[model samples]
Target: MQRDAARLLYGNAVAGIMISLLTSSFLVFAFSYPRVDPLKKMWWFGMFILLLFRFIDVIWWKIKLQNTEFDGKKSITHFVIGANITAIMWSIYLVYCTNQVNDVQLTTTIIAIAATAGGSATVLAAHKYTAMFYPCILLVPGSIGLLLSEEKSLHLLGILGLSFAFVMLLISRKSANFTVHTLFLKNENSVLIDSMEEKVKQRTQKIYELSNLDPLTRLYNRTAFLEQLKRVTTKSEKQFALLFIDLDGFKKINDSIGHKAGDDILRETANRLNQFTSNTQLVCRWGGDEFLVVFAETDEKRAVEKSNKLISLLSEPHTTENSILSVGATIGIALYPNHAKTEDRLIQLADMAMYYQKKQMRSAVCVFNEEMEELFAYDLHLKNGLTKAIENKELRLVFQPIISSQTLKVAAFEALLRWQLKGKDIPPDEFISIAEQYGLIHEIGAWVLNQACLEVKNWNTEQEVIVCVNVSVIQLQDDNFISIVESALSENLIPPELLHIEITESVFASDLVVITDQIKSLQAMGIQVSIDDFGTGYSSLSAMQDLAVNMVKIDRSFVNKIDSNGKAIISAVMHMSEALNFTVIAEGVETQEQSQALLNLGVHYFQGYHYSRPLEIKNIPAYLEENQNNT
Candidate 1:
């Protein structure tokens, strides 16, 4: 502040000194030559020398201002004070010299000196005290000369001069105050604008960071990952490894413990990847339970090895407060030069490989191969044709009988979907997932419900047998799903008791309250609810209990090749069902021994290829009669 004040008032003081010097020299040269009193001439010469001294002082101060750095208030105050004192002394000397001259000489000297003070008032007005003091000091020399005046007229002139100096001082002080205030407001506005700009800069930076980074793991998000992939593929000649990593069985973790535990598992997975990965690899969260790792400098072999190491690292048990979580990564690797040339193709190939491992449902890394691409192309073709296939009535269903062990007779039939496109049967495993992925499951599910309810109602004269339609999780969540099911039953004139809505236990992970309400509403309408592939999910007993389910169908995995542990698990499940008052239906009973074993465990229902393969709707009546005849 002091330095700025000094700089501001500098021009005024410099102008004051220059005016004094110029005027004094002019007065001495103009009036001293013709007929001068020796004493008066000497005094005028002394005044000229004093003005010259004042000019030198002003020049020296300006040089110092350029040469030396003016710092804080104290040094600037001292410097300004010295300049102001010199100005006052010049005014005092001019008055003393004028008092010794004749009236004409005095009149001219006072006018020149008063003009110098007048200029100072306008120039130095921004400094209030300095402006006020300047005119007062100038009036001192004239006022003193008036006090010792020999003539009354001279005295009145001196008094008038004093009054004029006082008025100039008041004007200078008011102008200085106004100028100082205006400058202060401009300075404050400048500071405020700068502060607001800085805040905006910081906020924009933070928003950018959040958009790029994942909150939980601080890895790049899907958008950032894709951008990085595009940059790498487009700009670099180097071949990179794109690894798509999916955590196997993440749904069970979420179903068993909850989403918070699931988040912890994901975080642990990310931390393990970060620790095990090489520095060149950029790890990112592709989406839920999925991560993408890009290796910038590596070959097929090194990439495989790196991916395998990452899988091993993730397999290490992560001990959480709830339970020990051990998740495995199914890695899919596609090399930049070898497998794909574009970013989308690279991610697609890697994702196809990852999904291949996901089908196996364990820790396995697969490299993109020519065969995989061929298979992906076929799957893509099926996906493209599915909507058309649905419209053309190419979708159909066949029923597999569930036999009662106690009665050795058909109890209920499970409706299985089939897509026959141009005389070729697309496997349910392939088309079903594709339907779920493409959000066509709701329509497919409604079709299945309509067909099965109508067919079963035709055969159900005694109203004893039920038809079960397998539902996808997506179908269950569909907004009009309940209406679809209700319309199927009302149109077919079928009792709800003869229609079972079968869902995998994975549905337990959905909003439990909502599922419970939905299930209760269906049950209230006389519909039977069952858990299909029961043991395949986490089987949160609470969810199973809350579902108010009537039956629990054991997954094929438990019954296909039952070991002692599998048998024990099956037995425990059977006992649990009995305790819970649920009927047990065993699936995949391929051999007589498997059926007998389930019968031994008190499971009363059996369904597998051993009894009968899924038959066409037209063949069901003949097959039922043939089975009755055999029995």
Candidate 2:
């Protein structure tokens, strides 16, 4: 738009200059040829006017020069040459009209010679080779005719020279028009290229922003988080705290309210977290329902205080159509130079602390301490041990009898994983938590499934005993977990219905869209899924209704004190299971009284030391035989 306006203004200025020059030239020509024939005078005046119009073209050329944006030295040279050509034509027309040359008279000859010489000089200076060459040719012959004689042949030769000069001028004017058009095209192309370059720069910036930002919440993602973490860690004079926060019970909200509402809740939660933290703090979305906050130059106390404030802010009720959802957060903090020297280790320590905090019933923040470091070191050692366990054949599966209270007979065996490091045995709780922390549970879970299926394949009993294996939340997160289970069953020639996977409530405490799909996939393959450690860890009745689960294993926390606080809890869980048509398994029955109490509450499936402790694979055969003989 601006370019067009410039061109118009330049064209108008050139037209005005041409009009002024043409008017002045005609007045000179009329005054000088007052006694000449009227027709001849008019013809001369008309030619003068045409020459003035060509001079006015100088204004148009000037306007073009003003509008044309030149990029380099070459364009400036071309513009100067075009301007000099217009100036030469104007000079020649002015001299000719003022002199009023008549073909029959020799008095105007000198003026003609001077005008041609001047025009030739201008053309040579402007580097218009074609215009200069023809003018020089006409000038030599006309000068020869003036010097030779006042004869009729000289007049004829002079006429011939003028006619040839006029034809050359017409050709030069045409060439000038072509040059103007070429310059216009070149300028248009340059403008287009500039516009494209600007657009490319904007797109590049947008791509860079998208790469670092989370699409949903518009916060920095894990990639950007690590970059900032490195910057903070490299500065030796600065101290900071990294807080690893995980949303508590976010899975239940997603399962009950739907994913759309869950996304809204996540966005709102991010905004609230940002609001609670100061501008100096950096908050990033650390994948899924996890967030990382970097508090600069802060100690554990201030970090925990800020984390608690964020938690409190998030705990406010978010009103939705399905329900008024309230959420809590567990934060783990690791201080710089105190926790670890590297950014990766510090983040790991913070995550470990956060997991430990979430395990506590009432704690919202856990600071990295010596004990946590020891735990992480131990876990690191155990992870290395676990990786080699399969190669060394150090892992063994033992079956604990699940006794039916009504029949007083073993109905199924829950497969328990045990690992022996050298001569020492590792407890399932210790290594299992480590496995979950290191995301190695999926591989370990697959190994357990294969071992259990292999064992069941060799059993010679006619009675079908279900083999239950516990699965961690991390195990179910794998997309191929169900396929792995099916492959194991097929390889061992065991029926899918004979294998049951027991997942704790914590497994369901994640995005149920994934968990539900996994459960349905397993159930579709004819495998039973049960929620172990029920009545604990964010369990909701709606989850049981929506998930494809067959049983609920009541946690021992309620079973241990059934005579007092446990009775009401046991009754509620049993009743809820019964109402939902789910089989209830009472766990941690250590005494005969506890077993009898569970029986009175109509609990059937029993698994604890009351029957047998988690036995080694060697002792399992004898235990089963002994129990069978007694029955």
Candidate 3:
């Protein structure tokens, strides 16, 4: 505020000088009397010198002192002092003129002094002290000179002069107050605008960071990676390798442990990748458990070596506070200019190779090849066609019977899904994995459940029989999975007990508590829940006991070697089942020898090609009748 006042005072100094010169000239012209001539000359000299000094002060301040370093206090002091001196000079002239001149001349002098004093009120308003005193000094002496005269008219003019001075004083005070208030408000508004601008800049930077960075891992997101890749491709002369790394069985681990642990694992994965790679190389979380890396100026050998190292580093057990979790990585490498020219093509080829490696040879790395292109195309075709499979009636269910060891009679039919496309059979292993990867498992699984329920409901067997429908861990994890099951049962008019849900042991690798609750919910609906391929999964007999499952099917892998070293595992499973009060069914029972061995070991149920290959629903009646005759 002081700085502003000082600036205003100096800025209007020229105008004050001009007005003073004009007023002084008029006074000199009017008061050309012989006795006062010398006094007039003296006043003119004083006014000339004062005007020159004020002019010099304005030039000096404008050229040398008007800056950030300008001293507002010192500047204001000089202005106030100079202005008061000017006002005093005018007052002395007014007094001398009032005494020496006639009444008419005296009145003219009073009018000139009063006008100058009133004008100075606005000019000196920048400073309170200057505004109040400059006008008073100019007017008081002139009014006193008139009142001290012997004439009555001069005395009345003196009273009017004092009244004018008082009015000028009030105007100057008000002007000064208004100026200060306006300057204060201007300063405050300036500060607020500056503050708002700074905040907006910071917020914009933060938003940019968020848009480019992954929130969980603090790594560059997919959009940032693509932009960087495009820059590298356009600018760099050297070849770089893009590695697409996908964590294997991550979904299972994520499901088995809680998502919190899953998030921890992902963070740790990112940290490890960042530590392993140099600053020249870019590492980013591509999405989910997948991460991408750009190895600058790298070749096949180096890419393989680095990828294997990354795999080893990541495969180390991730020991959390509650559980020790481990996941593997399948990496695929595509070299710029070597594999493809465009950025999108490079990324797509890299992703395709990664999926090929993950699907073909897990925990290994593969480079882009022509074969992968064909396979990728085939996968694309399958992905597009799988949804339409049901509508076209290309998908069918074949049942493999689970036989009772005691009566050698059919116990249950494990419904197996088959996709026959264009007269060629696409294996369940291939199409099923494709469906799960493409997020079509939920739809397909629901259809299979409904179909299985309908099939079992149409059966006219004398012996109590049920149909087992295999469900994926992904499907089971769905919140709507239980409702889907209920709808299937209700729509088909099949009792829940006749439609057993056969979940793979891999389901245990997910949120067990939640899966357990879901299983209990199924059992509450009077539906039996069984663990399919039991020993092959990351679960034990103790887990089964806690699960309270109705049945446990020995995995085909264990049952395949039943006549050999597999007996001890089966015997242990049998003993555990007896103690835990759950039925054990040995799968992949190929020959009579395997069935007899399983029977001797107290296995009560069997399912495999040795009894009957999985048959279409039309062949099921004949097979059951043949099995009944044999029994």
TM-scores for every predicted model: 0.73, 0.62, 0.72
Displacement of residue 105 (Cα, Å) in model 3 is 19
lDDT tens digits, residues 543-572, model 1? 777787888999889897576678988988
Which model is ahead, 1 or 2, in terms of lDDT? 1
Give per-candidate clash totals. Answer: 1, 4, 4
> Model 2 — which ten-residue stretch has the worst lDDT?
119-128
lDDT per residue for candidate 2 within 250-313, as digits (tens), equals: 8677766778878888898888877877545778888888888888888878888877887888
lDDT of candidate 3 over 350-372, digit per residue (tens): 99899898777899999999999
Best by lDDT: 3
Clashing pairs in 2: 10-63, 14-59, 14-60, 18-56
Query: Model 3 misses residue 425 by how many Å?
Result: 0.9
Q: In model 3, what are the clashing residue pairs, if there are any? A: 255-510, 255-511, 256-509, 256-510
Q: Model 3: runs farther than 4 Å from truth? A: 10-123, 138-335, 353-370
Model 3 scores a TM of: 0.72
lDDT of 2: 0.73
